[model samples]
Target: MTFLNRQIHFTAAPKRKVLVGFILFLFLSFVIIFVEPFDTDQYHSDHKILVLSGFGILIFFVFVIYSSFENLWYLKFRKVWLVSHEIASTILFFVVAGSVLYLYNGLMINQGSYSITSHLLYLKNIVLLMIPVFAPVMLYLRQQFGERIVPLPINSVLLTGENKNEVLSLEKGNLLFIKAFENYVEIHFLDEQDQVVSRTFRQTLSNVYQQIPFLEKCHRSYLVNMTTAKEIIGNSQSAKISFIHGEKTIPLSKTYYKQIKNRLVQK
Candidate 1:
């Protein structure tokens, strides 16, 4: 996606969710200052409203940064990456928020710098207050944007080749064709943008078919997604298959040519 498009569509959650989260955080900061439940050595009760309002503004900025990171970068990976990303982001969120609050607290008290011990205590308090508020919100976000709601194809066909250590996932309904490459296979499929992309796996075509039964064998060296097959040329003995949006012509072997023709006609 282009930078402009990515910025426009940053989060998978509806705009309502983001708006709700922003409002909740803003109100929560206001309440925390007003309640004065925690130790407030930094400011007197008179400045509580002002100090916490500053905190609220900081939270808003941090939230936007976190959302941009999610929208621009983190959306590409699967759940495995998301799990680690969430943990790291949580730490980063707290660190940035805590640092900003520390600077604000120092400036408020007319001190150029605050003691590390006092700042740590303040940070601890912030974390304690934020955990309860953010946990449920994060859970709701995961439910909205996660695999539970949107099924990604990567979860379906996880193919690993014997020659390569890396494992590749094929998204469902995007795979168009597979061409054999000796002991490996080169997969040609459509990406999220419906653009053609290729990935080479160190696995045999036969092994792939065992896992993915939907792919029909067209030639000894080629496996075609019959659903994408658009035209057939010549007879069963010697024929060629053309696919929609597929540039290369796949050989229609005599062995499977009849079956492919019949399937194409039926489909």
Candidate 2:
């Protein structure tokens, strides 16, 4: 069960992408921050810092939502990106909420019509406005992530380094293909039961490649079990080998044609 927590990649996830959005939000919050109500440079005051913080939080969300919607290339390698990205977003929203409140207070002051009695009162107003956005943001992030690591996947194949009891109860058998998942082999049978059962095999792919002399290296990532191989099929341009063990076709490259032909002839 503990092994289930292990990820295919070794690197720790990058800080969330939300931070970049947050920075952008902060830069744009100036429009409201410098408006007549809370113009910091116009009138020097220590309270201006509070106004900046408030505005920064509110604008964070807008930037995050925009950026997260785009195609970010950095997301492919680092898993931790969402953390920093989201934190930045969350901060931006609150900053916006705070900025709105403080700006309102300053506007009220200019009008001499209404004003918050204390600094605490202004702070309270800002915080009260920001809390409501949390639930929806979290829900949106979850839906966007969909519990899957990558939002858009290109080539998805399961590799295995070992062989014991490979089970993917959740996915279908037709989609099941073997590949090296780190030091272990995950017989990624997607359509099995509900749970993916992985076992500990005691050999590396390289070792297995050597010991199983009959099997041919179809690809750098794949080694076919020749004992279970039935026939080599396909045209010269795109070739694939049919396997008897899994009744599946392991792809063959043009360069490996000579070796594959030799093996089949020997058999």
Candidate 3:
């Protein structure tokens, strides 16, 4: 009985990948931010505390944003899109973090505690710090989670009515059958409580088939999910399909009776 009023489904990246990726990102950020390298720039060598705090905050923000956009990374061109997005996000994070550091460091310099340096050197150091954060993460996302990405249709189906603007992403798998009701269709499926639920959608049988091709055309008014079909009742001229857990039957046109039987055998 859940109501999802959205344009499309957003299946997330695998949970394991998100957990592992977050841990790796967190560890790397801590080391790069807090661990002072031997070749630290003179201008930055004294502001270790400020720099560490700034990068830490930025790293947390990046982790949240990356996880939220994980669905985008599951598309066919995932590696390219994900890496490009990470690179762009990293640059943006650097700019925001740099502005904060600039204000803090400028105040320290004015108070004569830290020495001044060329702005170009400061920007170069920020880029150097950002490289380790972005490069390896992109490579890891592409390599680790690429093959585990779920198929596009398994997660959801896009239902578009006669009006192209009227579109919805319906959950997949549980769909049992669709019945045409005049200009609209009734989508029947099992809900989480194991109860049969039917929803009215402003779409015809043909429109439904275009989005859900797996459904078998049993009659002019009905499309049944062959996987859920239990038995065929009566003869070829007047047969009806019976579904699991229910006695209600769907009329099967003689034209589609043989095709449905053949499809059942293939399954």
For each candidate in turn, the TM-score is 0.46, 0.27, 0.42
lDDT of each: 0.68, 0.48, 0.62
> Which of 1 and 2 is the better model by TM-score?
1
lDDT (10s digit) by residue, model 2, range 125-223 = 545543553435433543343333442233333222344554222212223334454675434232344333334454566765443334467766566
Residues 1-267, candidate 1: write the lDDT tens digits. Answer: 233222111244546446645765666575567655456434566665766677667666666666666655454543223444555566676777677767776676446667888778777876656667765665565445443223344436666677647576666567788899778798888887888888887788898897677889989899888877788888887799987874757789999977888898899
How far in Å is the alpha carbon of 187 misplaced in model 3?
0.7
Colliding residue pairs in candidate 1: none
Model 1: lDDT of residue 1: 22
For model 2, the run of ten residues with the poorest summed lDDT: 6-15
What does candidate 3's lDDT look like per residue over 13-55, in tens digits?
A: 5564455456555664566555644243343546665555554
The C-alpha stretches of model 3 lying farther than 4 A from their native spots are 1-172
Clash totals for all candidate models: 0, 43, 0
Against the true structure, candidate 1 reaches a TM-score of: 0.46
Q: After superposition, how far is residue 195 of candidate 1 from its true place, in Å?
A: 20
Best by lDDT: 1
Highest TM-score: give the candidate number: 1
Model 1 ranges with Cα > 4 A deviation:
1-17, 40-42, 45-48, 78-85, 109-118, 137-149, 154-267
